[model samples]
Target: MKVAIVHDELVRRGGAEQVVLDMHKAYPEADIFTLCYNKDKTYEEFKKARIFTSWFQYLGKSEKLIKILYFPFAILAMRMFNLKGYDVVLISTTHCGKFVRVDKNASVITYCHTPFRLAWRPFSYAIVNSSNMIIRNIFLFASRVLRVFDSMAAKASDFYLTNSKEVKARIEDSYHPEQPVSIINPAAKLDNFYISNEVKDYHLVVSRLEDYKMVDLVVKAFNQTPEKKLVIVGTGSMEAELKALAGDNITFLKAQSAAQLAKLYANCKALIFPQHEDYGITPLEAAASGRPVIAFGKGGVTETMVPYNGDSARCTSVFFEEQTVESLSAAIEKAEMLQFSPGFIRNHANLFSASNFIAKLKTFVSRIYNLKTDTDFYMSLTEKVVYARKEVA
Candidate 1:
């Protein structure tokens, strides 16, 4: 059967892009369709894929500029994506990629990262960081207009899958679709991470330095506690402002290579995840490195983090109920005091490995398409052979 994958844009190697990579891994033969592609910003593996881009590809490789100037065109481009010959179309999106026009007979499966965050909560969205009122207002108005199209596109899909229960709830509330949404957690490359018992004195915050990510809040929290050092690893629009806010104890590093990141994850006292992510992969990455997480006790982190109280040995994280600096500071203190088993943390992370994600995704797709996967065929053969032997006996 012919399968096609649709993604919003190949802009950067973020969590959404990682999901697309996994989707490609699950169906290597599937052709990828997107609005734009920036070879410099994305993974090299994409160069080998059968990627079809829209008319917007001529708009240049600057994703930030394209997003600001040509968002409406991007939406139009997504609607224009032709998926005629494909039997199944898997759409990976946080927005309008799911709107790709497909044949009436084709089955379309949408794996939503979240129902357009800007449309649902404009204030908390990334546009909040914009200093210019004119630009922010334009985005706000555009978001409201796009929301209608987003809901319509959602209704068109045959099946809905989301990265987390939080996003699943958002999808139901936003679209109110007739079909039920399934939860499939996005995964980390487990082989890339390593566990280490000798943790260093500093806490680590590995996230985009965005307003909604609240890396600034983590910086503020660390600023108050001079005894503890905080290492922030990521680059974003908020980098300059966040650096100004940080104290001497805080260090901001540009995005690191995979090996450097893994080493940092393995040695940090705990991974500080300050944002309410849709479905965070960083916490899982840290856990795979046998490090504990200290995260805001909301959103997708709640699903991943096994919070430590006095009694639970299985806990992989410590939670801060509020998003304020005070709450985060207290949580950090508690995290520092508590002890977590490295083996248990690594084992918990293994549950969300890339291999497991691919297996689950293949099973879900096979069921939806009413086709036998390789595993299913092998299992059937084994069963038939065993039955024949028993009958002969």
Candidate 2:
């Protein structure tokens, strides 16, 4: 099949990129496409894959801002792109991926991470911590425009898929009530984290320091636990302010390589996921390396993490009730008692192997490719207008 996979950007290797990578593996012959061809520092380190970029980059930040300001520009751009002769179009999206304006006959399935919170979430929240009113209002107005485009994109897609059930619920409520949606979780490679004999006595939080992510909450909880050490391994707007609050035991580092991060996940006492994430891949990465995750009891973690109960101890990670320092402190203390076996943790991670994800993904794509567009497809297309017209006549 001549598959065309759409993505938001090519920069910053994260969970979403891993999903795209898996699609690349499943459809090796597929021509990858995206809005921007981000100059990744480690693109060559990955296996060979054929990828393409839109000429939208030529418009520079002005077009980017326009696209961001008026989401229809993005939708129109997707419509304008000549995707003729492609059998399948898989949109691996966080924000902009759903805008694949192609022929209705083409099978398109979107793997939505979430509705863009900047667009969907309230504007009052955006202005909560911002100082400049003018910039914030501009952002707020743009976000409304973004919402309209997002809705249009969702309606345009053939089928909907979310990375988590949490997101699936959001899509139904926000985008379309009648849309068919499924949950196919994005996971990490357990084998990537090796069984290291050396133990490093520190807690790890490997995430961008975003406001919703609440990396600062982890810092606060760790500060309360002076005996425990924290090694934060990603950077964002909160970097300078967060670094200023770091104690002697907290080490703040920017983004690191896969090898370096795997080492950290393997050695840490536990991975602290203080935020309510959409679908946390880092927790699995840490568990795959024989470490338990300590997180707030909500979001995707609820789906993946079972309790470490009785003899089935290794099958789970620990959770806290609230996103407060007190709740996190108590969870940390409780986690100290839980049994963490490298073998058990590794076994738990096996359920989320890359092979399983790829297998299911291939099956889903095969169905779309084999679907009969002539008889059933034409009949359905006519049902929307032609059949109604005949009935009216």
Candidate 3:
């Protein structure tokens, strides 16, 4: 079957980008369509795939520049892409790429990271956080206009899938699509991470330094606990401001290589996930590495993290009820007191491995296309045998 994969942009490597990579692995022949492609910023595997970019690719190759200067134009450009001959179009998007026009007969399955945050939430909570009043106002006005279009795009999809139940709830509340959204959890490379009994004194936060990520809150929480060290990995627009807010206990590191990241995950006391993510991969990665997680007690982390108080034998994390520094600091203190078994944590993480993701995704796609699998073939044989036995009786 001819398939095409569409995404918002290929400018940065994140959870959404990982989803696209997994989709490509599922359908190796599929061509990738996007508004922009920055080889330096994203995974190199994308370079192996046939990537088609819109006019926005040339206008502003940088994701930041494109969003600031020509976001509306980029949305329009996405709609203009020609995806004619493909039998199926799989869209991995948090924003406008879902609006890409495709053949009416083709099956368009949109794997939404979330309904565009700007359209569904308050201006301050939007995906693009900025201090500039002019830029913020422009996005606010644009989001108001885009809400209608975003709904139309949601309705246009043949199937809707989300990374977590949290996001599925968001979709129902925001878009109210005709069909129920399926939850397909994104996964980590389990093979790369192994349980390590030895750990460093420092805590770790592996996330983009964004407003919504609440990295600054983590920094502040660590700052208050002068004895505890916090190592932050990942860079974003908020890096400089976050660094300014950080105390001596907080150490900010730019994005690390996969090898370096694995080591960091293995060595840290626990992964500090302050943000409420759609379906957080970092927590799973940490668990897979036999490390505990200290997370905000909300969003996707609730689905993956077995809280210490709830499941002592298999617990991989402790939670903070609120997003405040006090709550987080309290959680950290609690985490210090708790003991988690590395074997148990690793076993919990194995439930969400990449192999399992691919298997489930393949089954989902087969059902959509009405394709028979080996399991289905065996079931049919069993049915035939039952019919023959009844006839003989």
Best by TM-score: 1
Query: Please, what are the lDDT tens digits per residue for candidate 2 over residues 244-292?
Result: 8777789988877778888998888888989887899988888788888
* TM of each candidate vs. truth: 0.89, 0.88, 0.88
Give stretches of model 3 more than 4 Å off.
69-71, 124-139, 371-393
Better of 1 and 3 by TM-score: 1
lDDT by residue for model 3 (1-393), tens: 788999999998888898898898899988999999999889988989999999888787776786676457877888788788987789998887886877655667789998887677745565346447877777778778778667666666767888888889888998776556899899788888987768999999998887889998998887788898989998888999999988898898897888999999999999999987778889999999999999998989888889887555679999999999899999999888877799999999999888788888878876766532455753442343334223322
Q: How accurate is candidate 1 locally (lDDT)?
A: 0.82
| Backbone Cα, N, C clashes tallied per candidate | 0, 0, 0
Q: Model 1, 224-252: lDDT tens per residue?
A: 88878999999988999999988999988
Q: Tell me how many residue pairs clash in candidate 1.
A: 0
Candidate 2 regions with alpha-carbon error over 4 angstroms: 41-47, 60-76, 123-125, 128-140, 177-179, 310-312, 377-393
- Of models 2 and 3, which has the larger lDDT? 3
lDDT, residue 10, candidate 3: 91
Clashing residue pairs in candidate 3, if any? Answer: none
